[model samples]
Target chain A: MSLFGRQSKRDLHSLAAPYALDALEPHERARFEKHLRTCDRCTAEVRALSEDAVRLAWSTAAPAPLAMRDRVLAAVRNTPQEASPLGAAPPRPHHLPAHVWGTEPPPPRRRAPRMRPLFAPLATATAAAALVVASLFAVQATRTQDQLDTARAQSREIANILAAPDARATNERDARGRGIGVIASAKEGRAIVTLSGLGDLPSGRVHQLWLMRPDVQPRSLGLFQGDTPLVTSGMNDDATSLAVTVEPNGGSAQPTSQPIAQLALKSVGFGE
Target chain B: MEADELLVRVAGGDQKAFEELYGLVSGPVFGLVRRVVRDPAQSEEVAQEVLLELWRSAGRFDPGRGSALSWILTLAHRRAVDRVRSARAATEREQREGMRAHHPAFDQVAEEVEAGLEREWVRHCLERLTSLQRQSVTLAYYDGYTYREVAEQLSLPLGTVKTRMRDGLTRLRECLGGVA
Candidate 1:
């Protein structure tokens, strides 16, 4: 979805720097981050900028109070380390020059052909160039049209989530980097769920989505593949959370494997 | 010991490594949190929470992904920023803070942290950014203002502020001599 939940990739790319700075509002941050998973260039750029931000933090080196360290370490001694076996994030490529995406590349240099003496030839060449440009633009327009059509189609249900007076978006990621982002309207009893970094599963294994309620069984919202966002209803005023699990193809009546990821749906709202 | 390696060891339940990591990073973590959170009690509280999180979540640190220092500072910064974002009526007063957040606020932060070599280096590089870019980076990073709030404070368009932050940080990295 764009900034208001209609995602335009160009606008989302510009958010990398702000995202690194922790400068975005919650819903916007969730949206950009959901975009970040599939975006390799932005990932590299964020890592590089994050390195710079870390340097900015290095100067504030006031020593911790003597008693504070003991408190923390004591807590640490009692706290068991998480058993999460997720490996480190894959290495990021080198950051590209800043503003590679911000400023448009310099217009391609046009070679000045010397057709000065032949007016007829110049006219012919001009027509051919115009035709080429038109066809190229037509191809681009078609692609944009297809994307717009998809956006419009999904907007019907998603807009219910984004436009709700109490629309709220939340995002959660596992240590493995698979994440889920949801925008839901409490009043409308509707939600839009988006998944990221969950790549294709092996044959016969599919990703399942469930609406976990307090008293009832985790209801199946249906299975998801690829990167499409899902819209589910039946959210009541309760502490509901979304969970995703891997199950055999078709679907499982219940989540078999431990949830690969889960996000609690707390007071979902996007008022800001 | 290398910071990430120590974190990995801590992940493996190495108590010694956890202690060693604390001695190394605790100051920087506390300082960064204090810089943003401002209040001593809350800053210490947030810092303690972040360090404890460092212990419990150490298993998630991937050496291949990034430096341990960067990862920990990120955790600290986010927690600090979130603390302020919720506690303060920032949006209501952000417009008023605009004029005050410019050179004076930037100067105070730069001067406060001037004791370290990296602080001096960062101050020098921050000087290279154009005015808007500098405001965009400093207000968000130091003052714990959201970019939207930064936009309100600086009276710049949101898009403009976002780009300035990216461009400003990019320039800072360049001045600091490119990505390592």
Candidate 2:
């Protein structure tokens, strides 16, 4: 009995158990999800079977090593609770080049295209070339539109964070009183670090952000390029300060250089 | 506070609630990952990831969909399965081809070692399944093998494996009702 033999609802229904278990092949999973959008029966079955699986999960419960509890609680203290609306967009892939912001130069034109006019009648070839150029422009236009959409979605995420009631911003300045950086943190532990006036670095170096809590070593949040704002979801709630240091590219396991600047966070709004 | 209520507080950025929720679910979450990954160190890492994710995404949890424990365990299971599947794909492929030729039939002795009443009930329910059904369910659920891999391991047709799993889970669901 081939599972895919029929396109009927009953055929898709049989997949509920496997689907809930994450056992379906990617393609089959996709198909079932499309069906699941409308099939309440399958949805109910999956929910029920999932409860049963959870029971089986509980039956195997053994105490996690004691150390895990400490680590998990410490992490929770540092992590932000995400607002539901912010999760609507699928997470953007990390480590994407800055070109996703549409800043990269367009590819150079092929030299062969310039030479094509010599062999064909100049007028006819020019007309055909114009058509090709128009098509290429359309493709580039589509790609640029996609980049714009992504930027807009990202901007919305930033706006949502900033608009949070508990949001607080602090400016960090260099020795000459020049504001070099800003850190915005919320009660939820979400932080956005934005930098300015730090001229571009030579190759093999990047700016890294660290969260410094009393009685704990600074933890590296991640590295960022250009002057774009860096969003960190796990800024420690107890972190007294945020700092930026220059590190070898791809970032170091720890801050290897003195921080160029640091922002001391003050408890604001609600009583601490 | 209950797990669900604590999760609600966690969503409101209550660190104390988040800590409580972790204390509540971490054991079951770790045990489930340990069962599938069978590596204490890696399982701990995966369990940590799941708990942190739960904290970060607490707002996304809808109590109407399922209990907090179920949702957390499901997430842990998926992450653990993903880790083991990618890590063992090549080795599992080779072993799966000759698995039936050399592997002994599913052992009953292993099932008897579960001492608690809950585990005993699970074993009893699992025993009621046909041997093939039991094997299919255990491989797919506990071992974290995909149905295709389960079929390969058992040297059975994919359709038969799928049918058996669906039937086995349906039976388990009925037998463990109220008690579960």
Each model's lDDT comes to 0.68, 0.63
Q: Could you tell me the lDDT of residue B166 within candidate 1? A: 91
* Shift in Å, residue A109, candidate 1: 46
lDDT per residue (tens digit) for residues A1-272 in model 2: 45555545676787887877767766887798788778898888888877766767777766787755644553444333445332222233332222121111112221100001011111111111121122222223334556646545545454455445444433445655433333243466675566556767889999988888889999997787565556677666677777888998899888998987777765321123
What tens-digit string does per-residue lDDT give for candidate 2 at B1-180?
A: 899899888878877788788778887888788877776766766666677667666766788777777777887887777766665664556577866333323333134244777877888888888898888888877777788878898899877887888888888888887784
Stretches off by above 4 angstroms in model 1 are A1-7, A84-272, B90-109, B178-180
lDDT per residue (tens digit) for residues B34-81 in model 1 = 898787866776677678667756766777768899989988888788
Residue pairs whose backbone atoms clash in candidate 2: none
* CA shift of A11, model 2, Å: 3.3
* Candidate 1 docking band: acceptable
Please estimate how well model 2 matches the true structure, expressed as its whole-model Cα lDDT. Answer: 0.63
